[model samples]
Target: MWLNAILGPVSSPVIWVPASDTRKAWSSNARSSAATHREVFCSQGIFGGFMLGVKSISGMAFSFYDWEQLELIRRIEIQPRHVFWSESGNLVCLASDEAYYVLKYNPDVVARARETNASVTEDGIEDAFEVVGEVNETVKTGLWIGDCFIYTNSLNRISYYVGGEIVTISHLDHTMYILGYVAKENR
Candidate 1:
């Protein structure tokens, strides 16, 4: 489901909702007094992954779930923080200024649990990130960098192609970015 909100002084306020019935409750924010405020807190839980806290204000707070439970594992009093899943299902939280935290899960355990499991196939070689080039394709997608390759959709032009190479380029148009190369496998 998709949601959009516009806040401002208008003649008539309009609320739009999807047709589907699936819905979840979210926290709300309010002001208590001139010097105090009430904030609605939220978090995201990706099954078999991590839990990340979602706050309303910028540069206010960030959190990660405990390794065992998808609950608030650690909370940091910071500002302008963002959290999301990396390429490998790892929880990544970006905190104050330029600070970042990356977490990963055990692949062996995950693979064995699936009913139809197969050998884990790595996209490319171990050092696949070292190759430099340009983005040959521009997917309206996201990327992440972990113990391996990380793709970022918001990372603007010069970005990494998950399971591919890293390129230093002139410009990242729909075609010019060389994601990865077809070289001999050295595993």
Candidate 2:
């Protein structure tokens, strides 16, 4: 199922929804409140491999849809600060404020979604897939190579996580980004 973004500056509302088989993008009114002040924030979302996601800065909202088909994968009120994917896009690492979660993507979820006519969610997604692992660490930066997720935490320590455990850890002199991995020399 596909619906357009509920986007607007809190005025003259317009809903972006699918027109027959074609989807359109338009602005919609933002739902407001005293605490929130306004609604529907947008940002430069994340894109990697075949996935793209619109995640707000305040961690209030997010939506990930298919770039080509415009299929809605999910929509929720909270989003991770960082999301990293394996080269195959089958494994994912979701870095939140307190912890990072590793999840396995079910290839059949999309097919099952077309059947349910609903976007998948945790409670009723029924895809038989879920978070595979979690570590109580806030990752500064990380990258995925095969089954292991290598990341640096606030302690400036580089740790390799695989199979639900931290397999290795080493202290770093300074902060740096993980550009890529070379298997032959093993860094």
Candidate 3:
């Protein structure tokens, strides 16, 4: 299935363009949060052919965009203080004030939605995530290594987490942020 894309000026409405064939593309008069152009949040979906976190009146809005139903923005009900996604876009870590969750986006849902040529229901997109792995700690910032999550916390501790379990732990002299990871050097 060809993954469609949402385009057009942020101030106006959104245009859903089929990346493969612009001729079949259609536009929507409905407003999207993208119109606000808020920074410090929002990431394009890397693995799932969707968009990640976006800010909404409800704090943070999570939605999925696909080719079949290009107009509807079915939202998942969850607000996180911060969001960290993987390079390939398959994995995401959502952080709140007290805990963080690691979610693996399931591509099968997108495939099924395309096959049926139906709009993916809200529950469909929500079920697209593997059971979220939660850890009871406040994360300041984080990065992703494959399915693993590496982060620095409010306690000034650097921890490597696999499925939300601490695999290795270390302390930082001062609070430091994890910019990114180099897969080649494994730094």
Q: 28-105, model 1: which lDDT tens digit per residue?
A: 232111011122233321112233243424434444333322223344453423343454554342323343333344
Q: Where does candidate 2 stray beyond 4 Å?
A: 1-41, 116-129
- Candidate 1 C-alpha error for residue 41, in Å: 4.0
Please provide TM-scores, in order, for all candidate models, with all chains considered together: 0.35, 0.66, 0.64
lDDT of each: 0.33, 0.61, 0.58
- Candidate 3's TM-score reads 0.64
Q: Per-residue error at 151 for model 3, in Å?
A: 0.4
Give the per-residue lDDT digits (tens) of candidate 3, residues 1-187: 3332443433332332223332221123322433223322233221123343343444455554443434333355556677776767677777778888777777777566657756566444445677468888899988878777888999899988886569647887898998987879989
**Which candidate achieves the best TM-score against the true structure?**
2
Clash counts for the predictions, in order: 15, 1, 2
Clashing pairs in 2: 7-28
lDDT of 3 at 154: 91
C-alpha RMSD values across all candidates: 13.5, 9.2, 8.2
